[model samples]
Target chain A: MSFLIGDGMTGGYGSADILHDCTIAVEKGEIAVIVGPNGAGKSTAMKAVFGMLPLRLGHVRLEGEDITALTPQARVAKGMAFVPQTQNVFTSLTVQENLEMGAYLRRDDIRGTMEQVFDLFPILGEKRRQPAGELSGGQRQQVAVGRALMTQPSVLMLDEPTAGVSPIVMDELFDRIIEVARTGIAILMVEQNARQALNIADRGYVLVQGENRYTDTGEALLANPDVRRSFLGG
Target chain B: MVDILNALVLFSNFVLIPGLAYGAQLALGALGVTLIYAVLRFSNFAHGDLMAFGTMATILVTWWFQSMGISFGVLPTALLALPFGIAIAAVMSLFMDRAVYSFYRKKRAAPVTFVIASVGVMFILNGVVRLIIGPDDQRFADGERFIVRARDFEAWSGLSEGLALRSTQAITLVVAILIVIALFWFLNRTRMGKAMRAYSDNEDLALLSGIDPARVVMVTWIIAAALATIAGVLYGLDKSFKPFTYFQLLLPIFAAAIVGGIGNPVGAIAGGFVIAFSEVTVTYAYKRFLGHLLPENLAPDGLVQLLSTDYKFAVSFVILVVVLLFRPTGLFRGKVI
Candidate 1:
């Protein structure tokens, strides 16, 4: 078993199973990208892992311990963090306050953790006093990530972190994600920009109809004809 | 220059002083409503009745204190009894939340569902308050009657128009300002308060950050209850406590909240003053106040009242309609709110 694993997961929001025997995993210091079409259950699988949606017939384990029954807030306390695709920041709060909220469960001083987050995204420090809502889209994304990093979690999940930003901003975010992974934190994210997402991904997952169609290295998936023709838009 | 000073004194006595006191009352009521809307995502139609219930509680304690010969010296004895009233109101709010609101919340019911439920609560609370205290007006204010008497003011200023300052009105203004400041400080500075703002801003994100929704809701209700009781007690001390009058206050309080931008606290205060000034200035028989400013030959003949005091409540309705027509999001544009 990898460090974080959603093994043989099968669930849907309603009665029918959207994720049919879907399995995804990531190790320490690895970046895993889930890429698929619009209705390919990319977000659903992530939600299932995060316990936002109850799984009917599956188990999710972190470090070989079952956590499928835990609620999202409980999961957060257990060193798991998820940043949603949209409305991810508390827009009314200052950038610094947003980061402080991320450390809600921590009993110890989080100043060191906050400084580390600021180091990863220095722009967040400059805009610390400004309300998150006033910041640009890319800058807001930085606030979101900075907030998540305040927890100093071992594993982080992101859903389409670069959904609406310009391409240059997207590349900058990907570079930061790479830096986060290099610090030995496992990264799992769903990506709308499949090509760019996979370019830096160590493990790439191609999901179709909520099931894993291709599970391989990013470079291997990029080189495969079937993956490029079908999902990758060859 | 003397005429100008007299005019200013008249305005202060009739409009500014009363408006500020009434504005503080309305502001507190609107704050309660706005907090409920922000955290629970409901209009809380029962808020006015809740105020009535809380004031009834305070009045009961004040009567008991009076019988025991206990007092707060020059201050109204009701001030000493306020905590009991706040506690009662807070418990009632918690009970209502658990028994009524939590069911619909768990069902993920529509906002309208909560509104209808609160209307039911409104009727129940109104009935309970009247049953306990009766519908007749009860004047619980005791101790010093006036901070500055009209005759004393007249002697001091040597002006024809006398400025009467009620102790209740003075206390209301000071207490309201302190409450507003403390509330803003809590919301902007404290961790729990910021968590509340964050939860109100985006619930899903707040939950993701490990902020418990249940705790937030509980805290919101408690704060709202405290505000309601204080506002009701102050207004009761300023005017008088009649269960029916409190039921009537619902319209104006809601108007204040909406006029200021429903979820914005600052807007609520601003809206309170707006509604208060409009109601007072419009309905007031301005003949005397204006006669002080105008030349004797130009003195008016009529009462010069824009609207009668009997239709003062309707003023809120009219303003509500105008505000809704012009700006649906409200004066502060609390669209996200």
Candidate 2:
């Protein structure tokens, strides 16, 4: 069974549906990437899965349990975490404090979890005491991901993780994501840099105007001439 | 030399000592205001009256304690009754949140609307407190009068100037410090305190991390109630309790809140001192202090006071205006919303 699934989801901010009949699924320990043209509801789909938006039709499930009516807090307790594209980190809080906040629900000691996140992003550990706002774009993204990792979520969702960073930094972020996937955590991320995203993705989803345009293994979508011309910049 | 000593005494009595006490009060009150702004995402205009309500509760309980012959020696009976006052205030705050504030929060009301609603709550609460306590000055501080008498100071130092420290004033200062220390410790060290900060920083994010908003709100109110009760009881003991005086107290408390960066605790404390000093010093007649420093001709005409005692609140208002104009976020750059 998939770790996370959004089945025939349709919803938006209000009456208008930004995600129309969108279906995406991520199995445990796999990296699923969603990429498309602007306004394709990439972020909206992620929001729907996380219960941030109203679902007019369809439902979301985690570990085969329906969560369509669950509040955001309920979703967190179910081992789900989401990191937005911008303002993702609490800038005022130190890096360590930010991570502690991610593990807010846990009654157990999170020192091991903190160590795991620090191991993934050594730069974060090096600057643990620094305010997140002071970090470089790449380091800030690391802090964002590290914060989500603190929850030890069953599935980690990120919207546009490398939206604004240098090419080298973006590559490094993707590598860290892969490293996170190796630890048996399912990852669902939306990416603006479509080609690179699909290249590293185990599975790729192409969305257009809130509808799924194509769903295939990352290699198949990369080789498809139609996808290359329309999404991947021919 | 004698004149300098006299001036120092004048400054200490009117500004330093009183400012410290008044600042402590404002600091506690503003901290609650800041917390509500941070966690509830609204400016609680009702905070001042809430403080009054807490103090009113304290007065009643203190009166009861006194009648029952319960005393804290020279510390005043109000000190013993404080916990009961705090409990009542906490219940009131939670009820206010559940009945009024939470509906607005659920509706995602505009922040301005929330501010207005708080004003409405303020008036309603003001009426309720008055109905229960009556709009009369109540002095439940039954104790010995002076910790240090003005005559004693004069005799001990052989200085013409004197520093009179009332038993209540001394108690107020000591209690206020203890409360401040306790509050800071809670905010920094406790789990609930951290959760409150998390919700304040970002509500959506907080929810995503499984931090319950309702629990945070409850905790915020509890701390706010404790602070308000302590501040109210102390202020009442120091001077006297008049429901009208609390409404008047709002001006300075808000001025202090605005001055310290609205969401910053340390800023609130600092702002309280700033407002207190300005209020006491601006309205203070500095003629005696300046007369010693200046030539006889320079000390002529009026009391050399920039403002009158009746206009003490004006001092705080002016400072607030100035701070808002130059730094709208506050002196400490609180949440810029």
Docking class of 2: medium
Q: What is the TM-score of chain B in candidate 2?
A: 0.96
Cα TM-score per model = 0.98, 0.96
All candidates: TM-score of chain A: 0.99, 0.98
**Residue lDDT tens for model 2, B43-123:** 888888988999988888887887787888866778888899999999999898888889988899889999999999899
Candidate 2, residues A1-234, lDDT tens digits: the string is 677899999888877789889999999889899999998999999989999889999989898999999987788888988898888887777888789888998889999999999999999999999888899999999988988888889899999999889999999999999999988999999999989989888999999999999999888999999999999988
Model 2 misses residue B207 by how many Å? 0.7
Q: Tell me how far the alpha carbon of residue B250 in candidate 1 is from the true structure, in angstroms, after superposition.
A: 0.7
Docking outcome class, model 1: high
Error of 2 at A116 (Å): 0.8
Question: In model 1, how large is the Cα lDDT of residue B250?
Answer: 88
- The residue-by-residue lDDT of candidate 1 on B52-98, one tens digit each, is 99999999999999999999999999999999999999999999999
